[model samples]
Target: MSQAPRRTVVVLAAGEGKRMKSATPKVLHSLLGRTLLGHVLVAAGAAEAEQTVVVVGHQAEQVREHLAEVAPAAVPVLQAVQNGTGHAVRIALEAVPEAAGTVVVLNGDVPLLRPETVASLIAAHESAARAATVLAAAVDDPSGLGRIVRDASGGLARIVEERDASAEEREIREINAGIYVFEAAALRAALGKLSTDNEQGEEYLTDVFGLLVEVGSPVGVFVAPDVEETLGANDRAQLAELRALLRDRVNTAWMRSGVSILDPATAWIDVTVTLEPDAVIDQNTQLKGASAVAAGAVIGPDTTLVDTSVGAGATVLRAHAVGAEIGPEAVVGPFSYLRPGTRLGRKSKIGGFVEAKNSELGEGAKVPHLSYVGDATVGAGANVGAGTIVANYDGVRKSRTVVGEAAFVGSDTVLIAPVEVGPGAYVAAGSVIAKDVPAGNLGVTRAQQRNVEGWTARRRPGSKSAAAAEVAERAAAGAGEVSEAE
Candidate 1:
């Protein structure tokens, strides 16, 4: 048996996307943290194209840089002028190797195109020994799209652009999807015959299918099972719509795998985020940048986590955490901020209105309510009370506060940096401790209280003495009236 021919993919990303109204190329616009072109490249990889070529024009340098990072395997070719899709494909085909037997053309903006669709199109074209195969779809409203006109035998005859279609042809619901797979030699020959004779004065790739039909070469059509997969974004509104669709698709997959998203509409999880089975994601939450939620954990109601890790059984509510690790069974927030380098140990609690940065809280340690713990270490079972602030930064440099195991940091206490609270130490309420406290000792720094005799009567308004004198005067008048009556 003769060996099968190698497959090559041509991705057209050169359009300026003037409709997008962005200085950035349309293909570079992000969709779920990855660019639109990135998604297309991923699908190409899934299709297992032996060689991939990208045709870039508008903002070529920017696209090339991104391609280097995301799809290094693909080669980029420049189309120096603003031309139609046909010209772009011609430029791309020049880079394809001669040994290739099949070439697939793709649009960069259609991020939802599946690899299976590409494979199926190629399979249909090869199995039927057809010269070309076009992906077609039937949309409810086909305005502004090219109508697919089939021959009497139900094979593709030609694609009629909306502006060029006659009254009868305009009513066709089957439209061209702008994706195609072709026999390599047939496509090369048809490209030479293309002309800039259309309404836009640009060579249309749709013309190739017509040329194939005229030459008596079989042309096939593959109607996508889901029309949405063929959709491409041209403007901001369409971009947003496509993003929502992609999110729904990704979120639905996670839910099917045992993740619970309380409100799917409000939960936004990036493509890089991972949620273990049984994890509950609440409404209005955004999980981004490689964050992971362990099984049985509950996150959000209004929370954002970036590059963070939530352990099993942990609960994070109304919190914003970045580059932090939350331990198992830990409780964080109704409003808490955990910054970079923060590590909350198992069973620990970072309560509401607390902010922690570059700090390590040992197992069972509790920083409950209204505290700022930064550049510090709290030992196991240590209690950092409400209104406590670790003075970790001075005028010149940042320092560290170390609280030994079982230490009690009192409410409204300020532990100045470069200080240590030893094991079993008790820091009195309202103390400002700048020096280290010995083990099992009480650290009190507040000034002693002194009583001032009659201070309230002398200095305060509405004194008790004034009220007592008024009562005595009323009693004397009553007694005098009784004596007069007698």
Candidate 2:
């Protein structure tokens, strides 16, 4: 009986990352939506690997915690000391337990490496039937990287680290990407012969290629299609560069698939966000974290949506929404805040400067301009006017307000909860409502109009106001006298 080949992946996430200038582990640093190591593990399918061993050192426990959440099946092996890459992999393999099939080793810091690239490397490694394969990239500036030295037949001769490279070798445009595939048995054998005799006084993983070359075992090289994928973030500046590359990739894909991104540079879309065809994303927008926009929806110019859904034909302009749902053809904001639990039905409107929290607005309902709606329900065709407030909180607890269908809540009105306005009711402007308004009734709470003449002139006594009032009074007296004489 032929057994399926077992594949193992070893991730090197053990660097201290002193260049990053932080307490956090290098692999734990996040950009876009995922940590550096999380991205690598996902790209490599480490979770589904027959076996995965993660080598952790600096902040090992923190990295272990992250692995538990993302790739629970992965086995973590602590390298208590900050050793070299060769030493880290040597320790990681000890935890694998399997001595046959294939072993893939990769650095966790290269978050931009794609799954397709990884698949290609493994395929190339097996097809060549070599003892080991090293992924290489020909970059414009290979200054700090290890240069790839090719033999007469173009097979990998050796990798020369920059610090130890001769002037001619440093000029080689092709650099080692620090990603590799090796036959399990061959990798285990080579690691046993590694020594910490390098300039850095650390065991160099690239040294294994030299040992294999001496033994006359062939070494393979797979040049990556995209140099950006071979990049690793050593500091904050490099991390930002990686982030920009990823952002461009995601935005370009969305644009190519019928979604319109008005300005790619200004718009930041998370990898998890989904956009259907005909969706338009305007400048300075950020769609993040499980958010979805259906076809014909237009979002942005300054909007940010996190964990929210925008329905078909909906328009969300200059708004910030989190964990909310905007229904089909609905209109939200020029400056609105939508908190978690908000739901707007079809054709609803949440106008400029409105803030909604834990509320539901039925179809055709509107909370227009400069209002706060919290813990409330507004029925179909209801209109909550500008400056209106549905006060849901008392001293101790929160309550809910209900506005029935066809109800008109006037501007500057405050509907104090546990209250309701019945169907077709009208709550007048400037009212402070404590009780419910019955069907077809008008609720009025403001005091009756009272006139205290010359109040501005008497109380304020401003020179400009007093002068204007005196002149107006003289003109009125003159007109009255002239009418009497006629």
Candidate 3:
């Protein structure tokens, strides 16, 4: 059996993207949670390229740092200055060995270019034994794009950039998509002959194809099946369009895999999110950053989950949670906020307008309505009533509040930490408890209620007695009206 050819991929990512008007490099901009370059690298890996090299220049260090984190397998080569695509490719070629069988060139900003498309291009180039292959597309409006020029025999002659093309050439509907595969030896030879003879004084990669054709080398063209797959964003608006396209693709895949997205148009799920089968996602829900939604869980109508995990059979409505783990069968929010380090136990309830941070709630625990529990732990079956606040921070330091099993924390109570409500203990409503309560005991700290008779009458000109008489009169009139109507 003949051994497979060694494949190398060169990604051109050094463009400043001045049109993007961003401080960050253009290829570093995020598309569906991954950087544009990241998507390109992923596709290159999928295409089974044995060696990959990235050419970086604008904000080179920053791009290098990011590549170190996401794609350490790929080598980074610096171009040092902004010249042209040809010059960038020339720099990238230096990193590849002379024995490399085939070389694939990719534009880093073209995130939608699929791996299968690339694989097909490689196979076509090798099978046809062509010196060069270009990925071409037939678009409706090819404005501002390079047109594919063919010679007398109808072979790809050259690619004429829009600025350099004549009026007739500009009318060509078939455009070069800026992706190519080249025989390694032919590519090296072409690079050595590149000249900055264009009007812009920059070496043109398109000139390489013309050179190949002049030498009687076969040049092939692979028309992309989908024109949109070859699109690259140069501005914010285009970036958003690409993002929408990518999001739709991702969402569609999830829907086909048995996840229920009520309104895919309004649901924004990142590429990193994982949703188990039968999970129901409501409108306006954004699941991002490695979030996992389990089966039978209902999330949103207006919720955002980042790096969070929702357990099976749970309901999270209109909540925003990050770095939190919600237990099975638990109910959180109609408007709850869960911050990092929060872990809600099985069958527990975190009701409306509640916020929890760095806290753990045991199974069956209930923090129902208008509460903030931070740096705290509530044991099994404990009830943290409405309007409860665990004051976990003091002037000098932060502390923890512990509520033992089966404890009853009354409404409007403040547990000032370093305090504990023991097992089976009861905390009275409106109390400010600073000390620990013994097991099975009640903790209460409130001023005794006193009745001040006639104080309202003395304090106000319109006294309480007059108010009561007015209420009685209204009641009598209502009763009379009801009797007459009957």
Candidate 4:
């Protein structure tokens, strides 16, 4: 029987990131709204790996939590205490069910790795049946990287880390990308035989290269296209640069996919965000965290969305939404904000200066101009008038405001917490509704108005006003004469 396809991806995420000086794990630090490991996992997924394992240390629990929450496919295996990359790989090996497949090792911090490059590495390992095939890159300054050295006959030799390399060997520009493809058995054996004799006195995985080469196990290098893919973030500045690069790559890809981005310079999008063809994203818009925009969706000049999915033909006009979902053909504000749990159905309109949180607006519902709806469910075709406030918060506890289908909530109406408006119910303007209104009923709570006529005139024309009039007359006389030519 033919050998089954072999493709296993091992992501090493055990680095301490001491330079970052952050409480968050290194791999968990975000790049373009995703953890570094998240980008690597996505790349592995794109590569169609048979299995993917993540080796985590230094805030392992936090890393595991993020993996569970954001990128579930990346199986987390904690390195109890990070000794080095070799130990990290061994810890990850324990999590692997079977080593029958070809193993591809990658660093979690190297997020810009392309699927093609990973595929090429796997192919190189399989074609030569080599014990190990390292993904290499030619860099201008490989000063601090492991130099890939060869023999006098130009054959593959060994890798020497910067500290271990002599001055002459350190001049070699070709460096290991920290990405490797290995025969599963050879990888396991080599990992088992690794030593910590280096300057750092830490088990260096690079040492395995020499051992594999000495044992007559074939080891080679597959030079990658982009050397920058090997770049890893160790500090805040590097993290920012990585984020910027990712933002550019993502936005450029989106624009090439037929999305019309008005200003690519100011647009920021997460790697996982999916934008359909012909979607229009304006300047200063941030599409973050798995948020997707459907075809023809128009996002704003100052719009910011987090963990939100906008449907086809939806127009989010200068709004900021977090953890919300907008249905097809929905129109949101030029200056509106949607908070967590805000869901709008098809053809719904949420206009300017409105804020909705933990509320569901049904199909064709309209909350136009200056409104606050929270902890509420507004039914289909309901019209929420301007300045409407769903008083869903009390001093002790918050409550819900349920407005039924086709209901009309007038301007400046405060539907106090725990109140409900039944179907077709109408709340009059300026009403402070403290109770629920039944279906088709009108809730109006305005006290009898005793109009005080001439109130403005009575309050005006005081001595202060007379003194001001006299001063105004004197100033008029002293005014410069205008020349009038006939």
RMSD to native, candidate 4: 5.8
lDDT scores in order: 0.91, 0.92, 0.92, 0.86
- Candidate 2 regions with alpha-carbon error over 4 angstroms: 1-3, 46-48
RMSD vs true structure, all candidates: 5.0, 1.9, 4.1, 5.8
Ten contiguous residues minimizing lDDT sum, candidate 4: 477-486
lDDT of 3 by residue, 360-450 (tens): 9999999989999999999999999999999999989999999999999999999999999999999999999999999999999999999
| Candidate 4 structure lDDT | 0.86
What are the runs in model 1 whose C-alpha is more than 4 Å off? 1-5, 96-99, 395-397, 438-441, 450-486
**After TM-score superposition, what is the CA distance of residue 94 in candidate 4 from its true location, in Å?**
6.3
Question: What TM-score, computed on C-alpha atoms, does each candidate reach?
Answer: 0.88, 0.95, 0.93, 0.85
Rank by TM-score, highest first: 2, 3, 1, 4
Instruction: Please identify model 3 stretches exceeding 4 Å from their true place.
Output: 1-4, 97-99, 152-154, 462-486
Query: Measured by TM-score, how close is model 2 to the native structure?
Result: 0.95
- Scored against the true structure, residue 149 in model 1 reaches a CA lDDT of 98
